[model samples]
Target: MNKLNHDQLLSLEHPFVKIPVEKFRSSLRTSQKHIEKEIGNLTDKISEISKKSVQGSMEPSQVEAALEAIVNRLSTLKRKLKDIRADEVLYSQRTKVRLQHLQDFATIQTLDSDEYARWSRVRLNRIVIDYMLRDGFRGPAALLAKSEHIEDFVDIELFAQSAKVEEALERQSCAECLQWCKENNSNLKKIKSTLEFSLREQEFIELARERRSQEAIAYAKKHLTPWQETHMKEISHVMGLLAFPPETKCHPYKRLYDKSRWNDLIAQFRSNNFALQFFTPEPLLNVTLQAGLSSLKTPMCYQPEHRNANCPVCDPETLGALAMDLPLSHHFNSSIVCRISGQIMNEDNLPMALPNGYVYSYNALTEMASLNDGKVTCPRTGAVFNLTDVKKVFIS
Candidate 1:
């Protein structure tokens, strides 16, 4: 005892004493008897009063007095039982305290164990689905009276249940849940308007998601959600839509990178590897053109530019860029100065000067070019790398 810590010694005052089941049984029985006796007395008084009224022998004032007396007696009986309950709690303070601690330990033990925690959480959540099944929730009979941690447990438990409720709200196809609600009105017998409101809100949320992907993308360019972005990349990868080599892409860079590339290059002027220029355009036409620009034989024959900025080979422009190092975009839009270069010419004949003179010119890469007839404008110097070749660089 001397060696016991504060908690153990404190626990000793109540000593883990178990409340006898018989005592609870007796208390319950007594409570029931008290209520029954009051009810029986009222029933007898009403019977007598009714008889007197039917016989036309009782005065209205007298009858009212008698009824008031019965109501007063009933109120007194209720007050007496309440007092008795209070007295019992006071007299059995030690037992009450210990039992409450026991209840808390039971609750904590049920939750603390990883195995039972999920199950117990599930059971508590059922209250949301089974509110009508709750036994006595208002006063002392509620969970709060029995356990110290009831509030915390309930808050966590409520949060867990809210997800299910939100799902119940969000589902577009709520036929099953609605049917269940009809049969078991306990959880969902609320005002008609509330349910309708919940359903509409969820439907709107779903519609917005659809609009962003399918419709809004056409008007404005934006980064796609991870899933859509991944899918696009996969398609490009499968179709053999590859970017042009640096020198060619610049005119190789000009052939590759774009106006945006120039902006990003200027933005990072002080950086070590200042890009002469950067350009990312779209992917090249994967399909073999019926007539190569080189093969065309006419009075300066050229296939007019397609309305869409898409790669003639690939529908969407494949990412293509030109800079000192690897180009930034499939179109070659994003870029950073990887190294120094002399000049940059785009797929067309436009040449852009590098921001920094030391490495003033971007790789005047002549990657993509067209001749009014068969012009060999852009040329490739280093070994041309295939798509499969670069895949090894960034696989993951």
Candidate 2:
């Protein structure tokens, strides 16, 4: 036999490959339903015969003949069902064989002993277990950890807490999340996060909207007042909400009563929590797969003969470079890049943080300052600042 290449060996449309397992399974289910209908008919006939016998409406000879006919029909249905099951088994075996062939063809048989040793040194399985736990698949993570004897490596309790916090957020109640944030407050503050205050503000808004003005005032005094210097305007706006009847349609105040704040707070809490735990807000695996899909969506990648050939998207030399070029964040478009030049900050074009904390490229800020004759207004927040107020940030 001629040695076949990977594409020919693993081709889904190969003549020897059986129909898809799902199609076979579906056919079996249809045959089973037919058999069930026949069984139901037999059961109904038996019930009718019993009723007739009880009422003395049918002779024993006639009943015996009816039962025999039903039994024969039932036997035939059973035989058909058995044949369908056999076909299912045969197809399942064929599928297994096809999968085995594909797996064998796809295996990296070219690796030498040194390369194999290097590959074995990398604990990818543990990384997968960690990924599963981090992504909230606790059951699978626990099972894998235990089976692999890596229970000491995984923090099952932290995973559980994360899951619980997520559930609470989904229900629009941030009480549990607030407690978690309190425990991680120091770390969150290091990141200059507004998460804790944001949660309190959301809660305060809820109190005012529910017509508990006194409680809302008390809440603000205890919580919102401490952050007043940093969030003074926001604190004042939230406090102004108490003056309006909850149903008032006042322009800016109307936004205070928007119910979406609850959802916004929940999302903010999750992002903060992830950051505190040293995890990216987005799952690494999901981001990688999305980037891969985006890069490989060109028509040439899906052609039949190209399956055995090197994929342009997967070329070793260009793969890392392409990934590096992908936007740092999925929400890159909405990120605080230079709105004027539409370019991200780089080492050469370091960002300057304005008074409002929005960063712009140093060059862009310079141009804006020159245009305004000394002071520049923030394109994002619309806050005005003197040229001297712009502080260059060294982003590592």
Q: Say which candidate scores most in lDDT.
A: 2
Alpha-carbon lDDT, every model:
0.35, 0.69
**Winning model by TM-score:** 2
| RMSD to the hidden true structure, all candidates | 29.9, 23.4
In angstroms, how far off is 293's CA in candidate 1?
Answer: 99
**Per-residue lDDT of candidate 2, residues 221-302 (tens digit):** 9999999889999999999988987788996778878877777876776677666554555554445444555644343344
Shift of residue 269 alpha carbon in model 2, Å: 2.5
Q: What TM-score, over all chains together, does every model reach?
A: 0.21, 0.43
lDDT per residue (tens digit) for residues 1-396 in model 1: 112133422342231242223334445667788899999998999999999999988999999999999989988888888876764554356455545544544444333456355544433442232231122133332344235333311222322333343344344344433343344343233322123222222232233334333333322222222224335553232112123322233332332223243223222221211111111011112111221321222221222333222233222222221111221222224222322232333333233322221111122222221212221222222333222122111111
Overlapping backbone residue pairs in candidate 2 total 0
